[model samples]
Each structure stands twice: as C-alpha cells, then as structure tokens.
Target: MGSYDAFCKLYSKGLLFTKPIPLKDGSHSMRNIIDQLKDSLSRALTIFYPLTGHLVTKKGDDAPSYHVILDCTDAPGAQFAHAVVDAQVADIIAPDDVPPIVESFFPFVGTVNNDGHTLPLLAVQVTELVDGIFVGCSINHVVADGNSFWHFFNTWSEISRTTFRNNSNSEFVPRPPIVKRWFLNGQGPIINLPFTHHDEFIERYLPSPQRERFFHFSPESVACLKEKANAECNTSKISSFQALAAVVWRSITRARQLADEQITHCWLPVDNRLRLDPPLTADYFGNCIQALNATTTAGELLSNNLGWSASLLHQAVAGHTDASIRAWLEAWVRTPFVYQYGQFVDHQSVMFGSSPRFDMYGNDFGWGRPLASRSGNGNKFDGKVTLYPGREGGGSIDLEVCLPHQPMKALELDPEFMIAASPSQAF
Candidate 1:
C-alpha cells in the first residue's frame, strides 16, 4: 500500500451503501432474505477471497512505519446480520432530512471502532423495514476505494439477484478483483515495517465536535453554478464538481469566520486509476486514490465570488498529471516516514468526495431501483461534504455536509449558499 494509503489503515471507516430491496411476497421474510444473502455472500467469498482475510500488523514504533499485511490463513467469513425496524420504506424516503433511524442500519465489524487487526475484514447487515429491506455493507477502506468497493457491491447484488430469481444452487461466477497494488512500494502489501510516524499523526491531532446536515442542488442550480464559474475564467474551465465544491468550500469558510491570515484547504481526492501514465484497468482494485488540495487564505475565499473559488479548484485539479502522480509515488518511496503535504488538513479542512461517477442510482438487485442512498456514519467528520447523484436520477447533486453546529446554523441563513440549494432528503 502507498504510505498515504496506509494512513487509512490506521482508521477503520468503511463505506456503507444501502438500497431498499423490494419484497416479493410473504415468502420473502427477513429470515429467508437473510439466508439467501448469506448463501450468495458465501459464494462471493470464493471470488473476493481477500475480504474473508484479515489485516495483520507487526509490532512497530510510534507511527505508521510498521508492517501491516493481509492474513488470509484464517477464513473468518464476512459478517451477516438481520434487523427489523419499526420504520416503513415510505417513511425512509419521505421529503425530510436523512432520518437518524438509518444510523442503526449499519453493521460494523468486531466493534463499532476496533483497532484490532483480526480476520473477516468485510461484513454485511440486512436491515428489514416494514415494506422493504435495507442492504448495507461495511468494508474496510484499506481493502477498497469507491471504485473497488462498488464493484464488489454490484457483483454481490448480481449474484444475489441471480440466485433469488433463478433459485439455482450451482456454482456462480463473480467478477474477481485484482489485488496488485498500483503505484505503491513493497511486495505483497508490505514495505516499511515501522509505522511510528503515523501513530504520532493520529495522536497529535484532536478531533473537533461536528454536526452533519444534508442539502440539495438541483440540476438547474448546478448548471447555473457551472455557467457562472465558466464565465469567470477564459483559460481554465471548471467542471461541475469543481463548481459545486467551490460553492460549499466558500460557504463553510465564510460561516466559520476564520481569520484572514488563517490558511484553509479543500482536500479533493482524485481517482488515479484512470489518470496514470498507462492507466489502470477498471477491475484494478485497492486504494488508487490520491488527495489533491487547493490552498487559499480565509480572506481570499471569503472575498471572492463562487466562480473565483471554482477557478482555484480547477487549478488544483489541473495540477495533477501523469508525471506528477508518478513523481508523487517516487517521492513517497524515498521518504517513508513522512508525508510531504496534506499533514495540516484536519477539522478546518472540508474534504469533497463521491461523485455522480459512482452511479449509485444504477445499482439494482432483483428489486426496483433504490429510492435513495447515503454514506455510512463513518463519513461524518467535521468540514466534510459528500456529493451524490440525486435520487431523482437526472444528474442533480445531493450534498451531505458535516460541520460544527454553529457553522451549520450559519449555513442555513447563508443566502449565497441557500439561493441554489434545497433540502436533500436522501440518506
């Protein structure tokens, strides 16, 4: 794994994806659905065998200079659970804030936050609702990114629907994931055997209190923002993502009222699987994302218009190239104990993640399409904003934001922020 990727291993926040699976009949009881899911996942383990494996770390110093390897010897099968909530499907999709009820729908591994490197790196929980079933997954971030994680999810759904409809008990083929590390150092997911520096990075930082809120940006509003941003710069055109992120970043900075001299950053994770010199294939899994950032003083971000923020985002994104990615990899190998940049990024840094590219709306598993989707509780961090395709499915964007309570309230009254936003009611 890349040193930067190893940092993720220190924390065990996995992606949780939930979609309402339609109930066929009374025969499709929670027990029956759970059984089918268990069987399908058991079969899936043969293909995604690595997930059945666990992460093992050798004793090391204070930071992430230790040897952390995947131990596949013990086959602790992925977790499977079933729960019945009083809420109904309609109640879940109601035009309101993401119900706090869905928080209990998540199924974590070992414990909610376990530092132990035991086996069974993956787990699933089938949350049963009044009229529908919630299929939720919690896979370790070290094992996958948005691309690989969704690949595993869709593949599991395919196998699930195939068996549910055909009821065939025969061997099935699942699209297997490639385990090779890309642009990483070492052999077999190991290099520097001492992670003391990473340990310090974790201990050095104190987490600030945060509150999460959901916001909506219709397709028309997104287009308007893009149009305005494009109007700002003739040489550099910002993408829709740039425009949206710029707006949110600026809005949050203004709400917080950081000092003019204070430096704030927006951590934007770039998917490098397709941006490499030769480029990685679609199936190449593991953490292939590198966080690129835009740095601006509080005064500049608060003083500028949305388009100005978009231009800064565009430049930050434009800074990444094939050579730069390769250079970053080379530099990482030369300096294993320290990360050259992104060290100061903390609660003050609002990171933008997820995109329409994930196609959450396209995931279908024998049932009708999902009415909505959301990231697991793991994503709730101060100054974090996630952009997902709207549940309406015509390319509108939904923003899931987490901030301080004061900042969130400030955002509610922020005219510039509210002019283009509505309440997004998907969890």
Candidate 2:
C-alpha cells in the first residue's frame, strides 16, 4: 500500500450508476432491492474486510515522521445510506450535460481519501429516483484504485444477483478479490509518509469554477479516428485509446488558446499490474497504477497532425516497463511524496483517468443493467477527463470532460473536435 500513500490527500473516487425500475408486477420492490443490496454488501465485506477498517497512523520508531496502516480488527462496517430524490430518470438523462443534482447523489462529496481514518473507507448511497434508481459509491483512493474499486462493485452486484436468483446467500463470489497488498521486496509493509499531523497531511481540495460536459463517440467515430491517426503516422503502432487521447489533448490545447511555445502535458495513468516483473493479478485489490506523462510545446502539439501527438503518448506508455516501474517505486520509498489538489490546476494540462476499458455498464444488481454512468465532485480539476465505456458498448466511449467555463465553450464550438464526438446527450 506504500504505492498508494500519495493518494491520501486526494479525493475519494465517486461513481453513480443509474437505471430505471421495471414495471412488471413481480419485479422486486424498491424496498426489496435496497434490502438485497444491503445484505449482499454485508456478505461482500466479509471477503473484502479491509474496507470496513480505518487507517491507523503510527509514528516511526527511529524517526519523528508518521506512517499509515490499515486496521481491520473489530472495525465497524462500511457505510450505507438510503436516499429519496424528487426527480425522474429523464430529468437526469435528458439533459445536454450531467445535472448538478448528480453530485448530491454520491456520499462524501468533498471528503478527501485521508478521511478514511474517521469516515468509512467505502460509503454507498442507494438513491430512489422517481421511476428509477441511482446507486452511488465513493471509495477511498488510498485503499483502492479504479480497478479495485470496480472489482468490489462487480463482486457485490454478482452476489446480489445470485442471491436474488436463488433467494438465499449460497456463498458465491465469481472473482474473490486478492486482498494481499503489493509492496517492493525490501521497502516494507509499513510505509512512511512525510507529514506528522493528520490535518497537515490531508487537503480538502476545491477546484476552480469549471463546466462539466459529456461527449459520446460512437464505435464508428472512434474507428475513423484510429484510421486517420494510423494513416497520418503511416503505422499501426498507435492504438485506439492513444488516438482518441491525442485528439482530446490537441483539441483541448487549441481551445485553451495557449501560447504556441507554452508547454502542455497529457498525464495518463498506466496500470502496472501487467507491466511488473512476475506481474500482479488483475484482481489484486489496491493501487498498482502509475501516472505516465506525455509532454510537448503547445505550438508543436497544435502544428502536428493527430498521429504525431498520439505517437508521443504511445511512446510514453510503451516505455513504462517493469524496470521503470520498479525504479519509481524505489525512489518513492526513499522519499515519499503525496499528491496535492493544486498540483492538477494547470490550464495547459490534461489528466486522463478512469479507463474506458473498465466494465462500467456491466454491473447489474439483479434488476437491470445501468442505463447511464456518472462521476461526483471528487478529484475534479481543470482539464480532468474521465472515460467510460459507452452504454452502447462495442468500441464506443463517453468522455466526461471538465474545463474552465470559457475553454469548455470554446471546445464545444471547435469544429474539428465536435466532428468526431457524437451528438451530445446525457450519458
């Protein structure tokens, strides 16, 4: 978990999954659905018991610094809440952009991940919408990354679905999580943080005023982007994700209207599970990801074709081998560094998170598949982009883009950018 200490100051990752209730007479009642979810969550916690635990701060024996550890013994269970919202599903999905009320759907709106010490590491809100249901989950990043977050979610839904089918908990978990946290051989199970006081270490980061918008790209559009990118580069080395990211990076840089020579960065999180030596399992339940940065001058990025920008991103990702990952871990263990909120405020930079590869639309809680997915007001900053698998599946993608109001308007009007993005609708 030392690899995840840097996330302590960051906000919890919040996601909202919304779907309509079936009108069938025998369909599960809202009360019944909530009860089933609550029961399944409890059973899931038995396997993922650490989530019910809190972070314990301990002082180093040799130094005056502090380190954090997960304490699960006799801890209280995860937090669960039932909520009622006076809105319909259409009110959420009919908008040109995500409704502001969506933020209220999630628990722990502004809480940082470090608050897991006092707050629940996992808090879920089952909001009852008029004729619909919204399940919002906020998980501490210090405990899990996006992969692990979804793993727990997927398992919980599986348990709920199975229980609903059998009308009993038969101890069925499709993929039990690997709770053993990963660490370097010589580093430690005890990781040291730089701060002494909890208050000094935690930050309740509030981003600057920004407008959030969802852009949908159909499979055809994404394929066209890949084709054009490959044709321009005269190689098939650039992948679909790389090509799409390049388009977003170039377009956002153009919209920001940065000076040609100004430096711009595209930071992408690379999952190191497969990139490490001997490789960690896909189900390893913690942060095994690192942020890889691709940088270029704004002038160069704009002057080049989409393929060129994508090639830069491709190289960054390809170069993140096991050796590089280990080197980063070694350096971090020597002198730990935590990410602060303000570090992501650069106007000329874009940070891509929440992979479209995640099984976002597949989480079915026995009733139905999610009609749409959304994020909450956590870890959002200017140029923050979260990618979700399109509801239509296949190769489609939904980009939840956050930007300052002015640049967002400019981006919306940018002809080249909008050409590839499908007609905007609520995701």
Candidate 3:
C-alpha cells in the first residue's frame, strides 16, 4: 500500500461526536455540561468501539495523530460564543459567499491554508435561535458515515441527559481499533475496481454544465408529488425518492440539450451499512462501504415509470455480487490504478445522499430543544441533492445546483418544476 493508501486505511476508521444543547431544566450550566461530556464522552466511545480510532486532537497536541475540523456556524438569531460558536464555520470566508466553515471541510489532499493545519477534520459550529441551539459538524469522510455519527450522538445525548448515569446497552458494540502500518511503496491514485465503461458511465448523468446544478423537492411537495406520480404510474411502491430520481434524470437530460454537452457520470452513494449480516450498529464506526459510479443511459432512466425505475435501481443493487464490497474497497485502495478517470466524459454528474435520521428538532443539549434547527451553510454543491426524513413519513431534501443565477430565476418562475405540498399534508 502506498503511504496515502495506508493513510486512508488508518484514516477512514474514525468517528465524530455531536451534542445538541438540551432543554435546560432551569439549573444546568455550560460548565456542568462540559464536565459531564468529559467524563461520559470516552465511555460512550466504548459503545462505538474499534472504529473510534483516535480521539481528535487540537492544533498542538503531543500525539502521532492527525487533526480534523469541528466547525461551528451561527443561526440567524443565535448568540455567538467566540471560542465555541462563530458567525461562520471555518472554511468559507472570503470575497466569495462560501463561508470559511464550509471551506474547512474540504479533504486534505495535501494543500496548506493560512491555518498551518490540514483542512479541518472536525467542523464545529452552532445554529442559534430563540428556541434552542443547533450544533453542526463535518467529520472526515474517511472516518464515519452519518449513521455511525448519529449513533454516537444519540449515546452522548443519552449520557448527557442522565448526567452520565444512564447505562443502557446501545444497539452495537465497537470493533477492534485499526493499527496503522506501511503496506505500499508508491502513491497517486490507489484504488482499482472495474467500471467497464467509465466515460459511458459519465455520459449518462453529467451531460452538460446546465444540468450540473442543484434542484430540490421540498418535503411537503415531495410527498404529494410522489403520490401524484404513483397514481400516474399506477404503482404504490413508487417512493418519492424513486420518482424524484426519475425527474432529476429527465430534467438533467433537458439541461444537457440546452448546453450541448454529453457528460454522463452520475455518482450515487450506496449505503451498505445494513447490507451486512446482523445489521451494523448505527455507531459502527469507520468507512463501512459505499458503491459509487452507478450509471445508466439518460433515455433508459427517464423513459421508465416510477415503479419501473425504482425496481431497476433495486435490481442493480441486488446484483452487486461483491457482498464484501467494503473490504474490496479497502483492499482496492492498496493499488494505484483505481482512481483514474479514463477518457473523461461530460454527461450528467449527480450525487445523491439519503437524509440522516437524527431527531434534530428534538435535540435538547440541556438548554431545551431548539426552537428551530438547520445545517450550516458554508458548503456548496452542483447537481446534488441530499434527502432527510422529515416530521412524519415525509422528508426534507437539500439541493445545491450549480446553474447560473439566471436559470435559478427561471426555475422559480416555473411552478411545475418545483412545488410544495400543503402544510396540512406535509409531516
């Protein structure tokens, strides 16, 4: 394994901890909360076990370990705490709208910034509102997935709520810590899995710059839209997600026609955490396993009805013979031929992330549940949509489109492209 590969192996096996300031029962103090976290945090680490590789370090800690960002952003009405919460997260701070906190979360592929440290491994920030507080974070991709992070957060919340006295067994036990050792001799690209037709893959999804922007289906809108599409397709199993994906695929193709490009790569993340036998714990730390480069022709993707499309995606997932895809990915990282973008294409580049099931609105980190909560906004994306389950069976999705401001203006004008369900209908 190259140093970078070995580094990744050591790296992906990390975890993140989050604390939502709970509804203060009128007597708890910040010092009291910190004191409790200090005692219970490490113990909670045990529940997250082996995958919790190393406790993150600050700027000059005496350890042979690396550091990550713990960025914190402020809410519209949040009271800023200089040492704990800042007006913006650490990455995006500039002449550009990108906040410093967003910039801090970029991966450390070996670029130094003004801070002297690699880009943040942990991003810590807060969303302040009259109701309660929201703490936002960005753990390194190498270390944990959203499930694992939420698992840890739930445990921390449990401990904090009970003042470190709640001792119920969590859903999963931790694994053994990964020991880092040299395995390769060279560097550059270190993963190699066959995606038989890479450009063909790209052409299907990322065809044009116009399609490479963001689009969202509000939770309220998505639920109703899915129902309408299901009735049109005559299939009850057609979930909002499947329907949205189909529309996104179609819209992207339309965008490509306008832009006159044929990029075709749509990289969708497959959550393989539960794909394992005896489903992994929500806190099963480390990079569990993810499948990327799922591709299909635009014509094929858009022509299908909701049921057909959902079934198609289901089939692709079922056919993945590499049940041990995670191990395969880790082992593949040892080679240098896997990360190549041979004969790059400009089709459609779409990334999809399922929303995390964190009960964010209910998170009361001792100050009472937040009146409202939201994600930090320093990050940006093009042609990507993140899905989160909402108040009921419904859900919220965050979209980051890279279209020029003018297209965005056009999108707003076209009500059919984006619409929301009534509040009564929305969960």
Candidate 4:
C-alpha cells in the first residue's frame, strides 16, 4: 500500500440503485432475480475475489498497534439478502417528505465491519419492491473507493446481463483489475502503528437540527451559474463543477454567518491517477485521490461574488501537476500517518467532493438505467457536501448537502441558492 492507504479509515459505505419495472417478462420473479443475482455475483467473485475476504490484524510489538491486511484465502462469499418491500417504484424514486434518504434507502444498518458481526468487506442486498428491485451495497472502504466500487458494480451488471441472455458462463471474462498497492522506494506505508482514531471532530461540536437534503441543478441552471461565475472572475473559462462549487460555498458561507475574522475552508478531492507523472489507467482501481482545500474567511468568501470563490477553486485544481503530486506523497511520509481530511475543519468549514464525470447513469442490469444514485454517507458529518449528476440526462448536477438545522433552513431560504437547485424528485 502507498503511504496514504495504510491509515485509510476503516469504514463501510452503502450505495442504493433502484431497478424499475418492465423487465424482460420472466426476469421479475423474486426467486429468479435472486438466483440470477447470486449466480452472476458468484462469477463476479472470481474476478473481485479479494473483496470477499476480511481484514486480519498483524500484531506489532505494541498492544493495539498492528498492521491490518486483506486476507482473502478462505473468505466467505459476499453477503446478499433478498427483501421484498411493499413500497412502489415511484415512492422509492420520489417520495414525499418521509425518512432520512440514507437511513431509508440503504439496506445496511451499520458502517463498521467488527461492530458485533464479523462482516465481509463486501455485501449486496437485493430489495424487491412492489414494482422492481433496489440493489443496496455495503462495501468496506479499506478495499475500494468510489471508482473501484463502481467498477465492481458495473462489472457485476455486465456479467448478469450476459448470463441473462445466454444462461451460460462460456463467453464472459472480465479484464483483471490491478490489486497491488503502490509503495514508495520499498518503504513501508504504515508509520503510526494502528493509528488511534478518536471520535470524529464534528459529532461533538456541530449544533443541533442536522439534516441531509438532495438538490438538483438542471443543465440550464448549471450553465447559468458557470456564466455568472466566469463573468465575476473576469475569466472566460470555468468548469461546471467549479461553478457549482462556488455557488454552494457562497450559499453555505452566507447561511452560517460566521464572524468577520472567522475562517472557512473548502476541500475538493483531486483524482491522483491522472495527476501522476505516469498516469494510471481509468481502472487503476484504488483510492487514488487527494483533497485540495481552498481557504477564505467569511468576510472574504461571502463579501466577494461567486466568481471569486470559483477562481480560487480553479487555481487549486489547476495547481496540481505530476511532480507536485509526487512531492505531496513525500511530504505526507514526513508529517504523520492518517491524512485526516477533516482535521482542519470545524462547524464553519465545508468539504466538497464531486464525481461529475463518473458514468453514474450507465449501470443497467437489464431493467434500464437508474433513476438516481446515492452514497449512504455513513461517515459524513455536517458541513459535508457531495455532488452527483442530475438524473435528467443533460449536463445537470445533484448536490447532497449535510449541515446543522438552522444553516440548512437558511440555505433553502437563500434566493440565489434556491434559484439553482430544484427539489430532487428521485435521488
């Protein structure tokens, strides 16, 4: 593992995918769906077999200080559950105000592996609704990040579609993914043995009235924001993602209403694969990401226009080069283990991550495209914001913002913020 991978927080993430009705006639039976899913998953296991394994600790000379390794030799198969719910596909997609999106959407209850049950790193829950099925996945973060997770999901879907057509395993072989974690100069990745992670910084501090909201920005709205941001910066160019981030940062900053001298920061995850000197392929299949933070005080952030914030984001993003990225790794080795992205954050900070280029709309296991895609976000705290593409099929974007109660309500009331995001119908 690289220096950063060793201290990767041991947590689980859940993904919810709903498959609507009108399957190829015979494919809707609960038994048939489960059978097909299990068989295809079994085939997929041969490729992503490492995920089936559990993490075992290699004790050091110290007490709780140990190296955690992925041992897949005798791994139990990935967990799968077949549940039938009485809710309709429409309700599942665009429910009226009901429950927390993550709480009600994902099938998994907890985000930890050793929280009582000896859980597999990967588990799949096939929830059958009155109209279709919801594929809820619980995956350990140690083994995969967003890129690797989606790769596995898409591969499984491909295998299932092939099996559904031919009913034979004779013609399907997925390309092997690189599993070797990179280490620098033959040096070890783990520095602080069994890093001690205390309670998250946010849980103890963030004020009451916490909530998660899903907001949709259509392609037209996104374009308008980009145009406005570019105009404000006196620069003719700004990306859709940058523009959206600027708007969000401004809205959240205004809502929080921090003192003039108080500072706020925004962190964006930069995919290190492409930033490396010798770039990794799209399928490098690991946590090849780093966060780029933009710092500004409330007076600076809210006082200036959206374009100023966007320009700062653009500079941070453009500042990453191949040599700089390598140096980033070197610097971390000298600093400390566990690059806690949340370390500098407080109630006033906002950490933003967006996978705008990911093919979130393409995973079709025969029942057609997903109306929406969501991360159960078990590890996220208030002031965390994640972006996904809007389901409307254009250049739209989906923003899922988590914040304290008052600030969230303030965002809803903000005219500029409300103008961009419509109520998400099915996310």
Candidate number of the best lDDT: 2
In the range 1-427, model 3's lDDT, one tens digit per residue, is: 1111112211111111233345466234445555554455555555544333322223333332232322223111111121243432211211112223332222332221111123433333433323223344444444455555555555555655555334343433333323232122332222332333223122112223332222434576777767866786666766666566655544545554433334344545566556655455444455554545545666665555544555554445555443555455456554323221222223255555534345544444444433222232211234444443442334764343444344445544444455541222111
Off by over 4 Å in 3: 1-43, 46-132, 164-237, 252-263, 277-283, 293-314, 321-347, 354-362, 370-379, 391-404, 414-416, 420-427
Query: Which has the higher TM-score value, candidate number 3 or candidate number 4?
Result: 4
What's the C-alpha lDDT at position 284 in model 4? 73
> Which 10 consecutive residues of model 2 have the lowest summed lDDT?
6-15
Model 1 misplacement above 4 A: 4-26, 59-65, 90-96, 109-116, 168-176, 183-189, 196-209, 337-345, 423-427
Model 2 Cα lDDT, one tens digit per residue, 1-427: 4354434333333334454354576458777788888999999999888889988778876664888888999586789999998998888778756779988888877777777778888899888887778888888888888898888888888888888877777887778889887778756787777776776655566678888888999999999999999999999988999999999999999999999989999999888998888898898998778888899999999999999999999999999998988888889888887776455567889999889898877888787788788887887889999898998889899998999888999999988789999975454
Residue 317 shift from truth in candidate 2, angstroms = 0.1
Cα misplacement distance, residue 313 of candidate 3 (Å): 3.7
The CA lDDT at 383 in model 2 is 94
| Regions of candidate 4 where Cα sits further than 4 Å from its true position | 1-26, 62-65, 95-98, 101-108, 113-118, 168-175, 189-209, 339-345, 423-427
TM per candidate comes to 0.86, 0.95, 0.57, 0.86
Candidate order (TM-score): 2, 4, 1, 3
In terms of lDDT, model 4 sits at 0.69
lDDT of each: 0.69, 0.82, 0.40, 0.69
lDDT of 4 by residue, 124-170 (tens): 77767666567777666657777777788878888887777666675
Model 1 CA lDDT for position 108: 54
